[model samples]
Target: MARITAGIATSHIPALGAAIDLGKTGEDYWRPAFAGYEWTKQWIGQNPPDVVILVYNDHASAFDMNLIPTFALGCAENFQPADEGWGPRPVPVVEGHPDLAWHLAQSLILDEFDMTIINRMDVDHGLTVPLSLMFGQPQAWPCRVIPLAVNVVTYPPPSGNRCWALGEAIARAVAGFPDDLNVQVWGTGGMSHQLQGPRAGLINREWDNRFLDQLIGESDALRHIPHIEYLRETGSEGIEMVMWLIMRGALGRTTRCLHRHYHVPASNTAVGHIVLEPVS
Candidate 1:
């Protein structure tokens, strides 16, 4: 059976690539941002998993507001890098693990978890930005990726409890796979910041830190946090932190924090990163 070895949470700030590419890491504004992921990069180098199940939301890139699924799983052989307003990043297309993805999809649905199975789709910065920060643009990705795209753009999306339930379902699905492989699950987005309308550029450091503490130590408390409270307190977009609960639920109740980093003012967002190793 495959064991989930690691869990990671990260913020997918679109401008992060440009900041790194421009060699601005040493600059006052960007230095701390780059510093945050350094420990995660080192850990990956030492213990690279064979597969990664990445959970992220597409920002009206692949699935426009026209049609959105609360939870979509990618089972395609390959996925194209989306051409956002500027253009697609110069990186090799992401290859998916169809065998594992299909198995996960089938099992989750059988378990009564409604998931949208996507045979084909393109991914934007939501997925790529974290990839670049964690692994950089190598000739090819270090491991196969099972992309899980969540719908947070629509007015009403999956609730925090629902996302956490999905995470538990995912853990069971991965554990049941017959293959002998190591897998890492990643939840990307949010640390209390908003983007949109006049409420843009909002950041609540106090709530952000408290959320992180509860996420790692007392996540069951998160289940009680209502959707309206997340919106009102964290900002509409900040509600995306609910996605992190999914990742947290997939790991052991007690996980060792391997790395953590947080920053603000990244194109009107608060960027945060954390890596965890399952505790036995």
Candidate 2:
């Protein structure tokens, strides 16, 4: 059976993707941001997964107010990079694990998660930036991807606990798959940032670091943290961190963290990344 191998958490700032595609990594503003992901690329290069279940939110690109699903799972054979009002980034099209993805979607629904299954959609930076961060400039991504879009942009997004529970469901779903596969679940977005109105550019490195500390072990504390607090302290956009809980919960009761990288001022956001695996 396929086994859960890793869970990754990260911040997916749009500017990070733009910087990568425009060859601006060397620029003063971008050097530090890109620097943090260097070890991530090397880490993944040394230990790559056959499939990655990516958890992220679409930034008003694919599903707008007209249609919003609290949780959506990609079951398509492929996904194209989105042009978020600035043209698509020069990245390889994402290949999906339709077989596993369909199983997961069905299982999640059966488990009472009610996930919306998607067969076709263009992936936004929320889904693609993490790919660029860990895979670097690859002609084609090294493995198949499953895009799980959360409704963080819409008001009243899923609660942190709900996200964590969904992760648990995914864990159960993946563990039951009847295939020999290595799968990784990734949670993207957040590290204390507000990108709108007068509060734009707000960042609380203290809270972010503190949050990271608790995330590894005392995640229950992190889960109970109110959404308003995430909005007030981390910034409205920072509430996206709830998505990280999904990644954490998917890694099972115990995990051995392999790598963690955090940096600030990535175009009005803080960048954080970590890799861990379920420990027997």
The best candidate by lDDT is 2
The whole-model lDDT of each prediction reads: 0.84, 0.88
Q: Which runs in model 2 stand beyond 4 Å of their true positions? A: none
Q: Give the CA lDDT, 0 to 100, for residue 176 in model 2.
A: 94
- How does candidate 2 fare on TM-score? 0.97
Taking the tens digit of each residue's C-alpha lDDT, what string does model 2 give over 37-57?
Answer: 787788888888999999999
**Which residue pairs in candidate 2 collide?**
none
Off by over 4 Å in 1: none
TM-score of each: 0.96, 0.97
